[model samples]
Structure formats: structure tokens, C-alpha cells
Target: MKVLIIEDEKELSKSIVEYLSEENYLCEVASTHKEAMKKIGIFNYDCILLDITLPDGNGLKLLEELTNENKQDGVIIISAKNSIDDKIKGLQLGADDYLTKPFHLSELTARIFSLIRRKQFNNANKIKQDELEIDLLAKTVVVNSNPVALTKKEFDLLIYFIGNKNRVLSKSTLAEHLSGDFADMLDNHDFVYAHVKNLKKKLSEAGCEPYLKTVYGTGYKWKG
Candidate 1:
């Protein structure tokens, strides 16, 4: 999944990125509120880790912007402040969860997973569509009661498609979702095509339905 980390603490942000990267999350960061706002305006993220404190402004304001825009991106407030009021305000504003600083990386990861599942996967660890089955926690995919081996990127592509099912996803959007900030530096989104092609081939070979559809000059859609 894609994530935006709006944190000013450099070391903490670095550590969080490193840990979440190992979990296969596409993460991008913004230390200030303006930077965070710009990124959120340009692309959608599956989850956002916002700190209560920023160099320019309060993170809660960012939450307000998101609410005002009616964006449904899942948000989790990660702040050094442990005040009950802060947590309450965050939840009141629109945060899905709150994590106090100095928390365990494993705990943060678990919370991120939980929030993503609840928001995107109907709060189920296992997702089943026809003969295809996906275990979010186990990170496995099965088709027609048989296992389907997919590379990490292919698996990510599958879930991304399913999470946003029935929506037309542009190649640039897929590129950003898969590569995060690095997508801007990449010359082209050929990788998006390559990965989606491989995923389609693998799923088709495994007897899965043709849920993936090409929209001509547009992009792809999961026609579920």
C-alpha cells in the first residue's frame, strides 16, 4: 500500500520508513505541513502518518484539509504528545487511529495493517473474489484452490487493483502508488505496464477470472 509520513523528527521518520519499507509499503515523507499538503493534493495514499507537531503548522489542520476535501484516505496520528485531549481531537477530526511516540515499530506496523484492512479490505484478513483468495496477513494468493506464486510487486499490484476495484486507474497513478516519491524521478511508467501484464498473465494461468481490463489509451480497471 502507499503511505505518506508527515513527520519532522528526522531519525524517527527514517526509522519508520525503513521498517515500513521492509513490510513492502510504498512510503513518501514530508516534514512540513505545506509539503504534506502538496503531496496529498497531488496523489492519494492508502494511509497517512501525521505528527501533531510540524515545523510550519499543526498536523490537525492537515486532517481538516483532508476532511474538507472529502478525501477518504485513511489517517493515523503519530505524535509525541500523549495527551488524551490530543487523541480525542484527532479522532474527532477524522483520524482512523492514534499512536503515541516512542512506540514499537511492530505495533505501528500492525496498526497500519489494521487500518488499511479496515478501510480497503472490508476489515477482513482474508479476501476472496470468486475462485481467487488472498490472505492479507499471510501475504499469500490462491486461485481455484491452488497457490499462485507472484512476485512482491505483482502481489502489490493485485491488491491495489482489488482495493480500488471498478475504478479507472491511470498509469501515472499506478506509478505513484507503486513507487511513491521516486515515481517523479522515473522517466516513464513502463514499469506499471510490465508489472500489470505479468500479474494478468499469472492470474489467468492460475485459472483466475479476467477481472483486469485495459481501457484502451487510458489505464486499467478491476472489473469486479
Candidate 2:
């Protein structure tokens, strides 16, 4: 999953990004409210870790704006403010969960997983599409009841496709989802084609129904 970390504390933000990246999440950091606004205005993320106090503006206002825009992205407030009013206000403004600072990283990770499961996957750990099953927490996939050995990129690609089933995904969008916002700095998207090809071949060889579809003149889609 992709995540945006909006925190003014540079060290904390960096640590969070590093930890989340180790957990197989695409992470980006925004040190100030302006940067956070720019990121939310441009790219999409599966979840956002928002800090209520920023250098420029209060993160609560941004949360309210997100609510007005009807953004489906999951949001978690990571702020030092532990007042009941702040918690109630954030929840009222559509924040999924609130976590005070000086907490365990594992707890934060678990919360993020819970939020994603609740918002995107109907609170299910295993996602099933016909004969294919994906265990989001375990980061594993089974085709026809057999485990499919996939590279990290291949697994991420498969998860992305399944999460957005039946929706046409352009190459660029897929690349961004897999590589994060920095994907645009890449010279080419040949890596995307390579990973997609490998994923499709593996699924087919495993006797799984072919679900990855390439849209002519566009990109690819996962169809049930």
C-alpha cells in the first residue's frame, strides 16, 4: 500500500517512512502543511498519516477539506495533541483513527493495516477473487490453492490489480502505485511491462484463470 506521512518533525517522519517501507509500503514524506497539501492535491495514497499541528496550518483543516472532496483514502491522525476535543473533532471530520505520539511503531503499523482492511477490503485479511486468494497481512498469494512464488514487485502489482479490479489502470498510474510518486523520475516504464508480464505468466502457469487484461491503446485491468 502507498502512504503519505505529513509530519513537521523531520526525524520522526523519516523514521516512519523507513519503517513503513520495510513493511512493504510505498511511503512519501511531507514536512510542512504546504508540501502535504501539494501531495494530496496531486497523487493518491491508500492511507495518510496526518499530523494535526504543522508549520503552516492545522492538519484538521486539511482533513475537513478531504471530507468535502469525498476522498475515499483512509486517514489516521498522528499528533501530540491528546485532548478529547481534538480526538472527537478529528473523528467528526472523518479521520479513521487517532494515535498520539511516543507510541510503538508496531501499533501504528497494525492500525494502518486495520484501516486499509476496513476501508478498502471490507475488514478482511484474505481477499478472494474466484480461485485466487491474497492474504494482505501475510503478503502472500495463492492460485488454485497453490502458493505462487512472486517477486516483491510482482506481488505488489498483483495486489494493486486485485484492489482495483475491473478498473482500467494506465501504465503511468500503475507505475506510480508500484514505485511511489518518484516513479516519474524514471527513464521508462519498461519495468512495469516486465513485472506485469511475469505476473500474468505465473498466474497462467499455476492453472489460475487469467485475470489481468491489457486494454488496447491504454493500460491494463484486472477482471473477475
Candidate 3:
């Protein structure tokens, strides 16, 4: 999953990024409200850790913008303020959860997982499609009761395809989703083709049907 940490405290942002990266989440940080808005305008994150206070503006304004844009990203407010009014305002602004500054990283991680699950999978930990079974908690994929060994990128690619099944996905879209902010530095999407090829080969070897289809002169789609 991808996460955006909108925090001004450098140390706290670093710690959160390190801890969440260890938990297999792709993380990006924005210290100011302007930077946060830029990132939000360009990329789609699975969850956002929003701090109410920022150098440029209040995080609540960003939340309001997200609501106005109809963005589906799950947001969790993390601030030092514990006042009931602030909490109520944050929730009313459409935040999924709130965490005080002096909180455990483990608890924060659990909250992100819960928020993503509720938003993406209807709170289900396991996703079963035909002979394929994916355990979101375990981060494992199995086909026909046999394990499929997929690299982290490949697994992420598979999940992305499954999540948007039957929709035509451009190479640029896949590249941006996979590489996040770094995608702009990339000159081409050769890596997208490579990951899709590897994923298709692994699933084919595991006796699964060819659900991934390539659209000539366009991009790719998951027919599942």
C-alpha cells in the first residue's frame, strides 16, 4: 500500500516512514501544506496521515479539499492537540481516524491497515477470486492451493490490476502507481512491462488462467 505522511516534524515523519516501510508500505512525506497539496494533486495514496498543523496552513483545509475533489483516499489525522472540538472537527471533515502525537507506531500501523481494508476490501483480510487466494495480512498469494513466489513489485502490480479489473490502465498510470513521486524521473515504462510479464509467467506456471490482457497500442487490463 502507499501512504502519504503530511507532517512538519522531521523526526516523527522519518520514524513513521521507516516503521511503515519495514511493514511493506510505500511511503512519501510532505512537510508543508503546499507540498502536501502538490503530492495529493499528482498521486493517489491508499492512506494519508495528516497533521492538523503545518507551516503553510491547517491540515483541515486539505481534508476539505479532498472532500471537494471526491478523492477516495483514507485519511487519519495525527496531531498533538487532543481537544474534543478538534477531534470532532476532523471527523466532520471526513477523517477516518485520529491519533495523538505521543502514540505507538504499532498502533498507527494497525489503524492504517484497518482503514485501507475497510476502504478497499470491505474489511476483509482475505481476497478470494476463483482459484486464486490472496491474504492481505500475510502478504501471500496462492493459486490452486499452491504458493506463488512473487517479488514485492510483482505482488503490488498484481494487486493493482485486480483492484481495477476490466479497466484499461495506461502504462503511465501503472508506472506512477508503482514508483510514486519518482515516476516523474523515469523516461519510459519498460519496468511496467517487465513486472507484468513476470507476474503473468508466475501465475501461468501455477496453472492459473491468463487473466491479464495486453491492449495493443494502448496498455493492459485485468479481465478478472
List per-candidate RMSD values in Å: 0.9, 1.1, 1.1
Any idea what lDDT model 3 has? 0.92
Tens-digit per-residue lDDT, 9-127, candidate 2: 98898889889889989998888888888888888889999999988999999999999988888999999998999999999999999999988999999999999888777889999
Q: List the candidate numbers ranked by lDDT, top first.
A: 1, 3, 2
**TM of each candidate vs. truth:** 0.97, 0.97, 0.96
Model 1 over residues 50-118: C-alpha lDDT tens digits?
A: 999998999998899899999999999999899999999999999999999889999999999999999
Estimate, for each residue in 129-160, the C-alpha lDDT of model 3 and write its tens digit.
89898998899999999999999989888878
Query: What is the number of backbone collisions in each predicted candidate, taken in the order shown?
Result: 0, 0, 0
Q: What is the lDDT of residue 14 in candidate 3?
A: 99
Highest TM-score scorer: 1
Candidate achieving higher TM-score, 1 or 2: 1
Q: lDDT score of model 2?
A: 0.90
Where does candidate 1 stray beyond 4 Å?
none
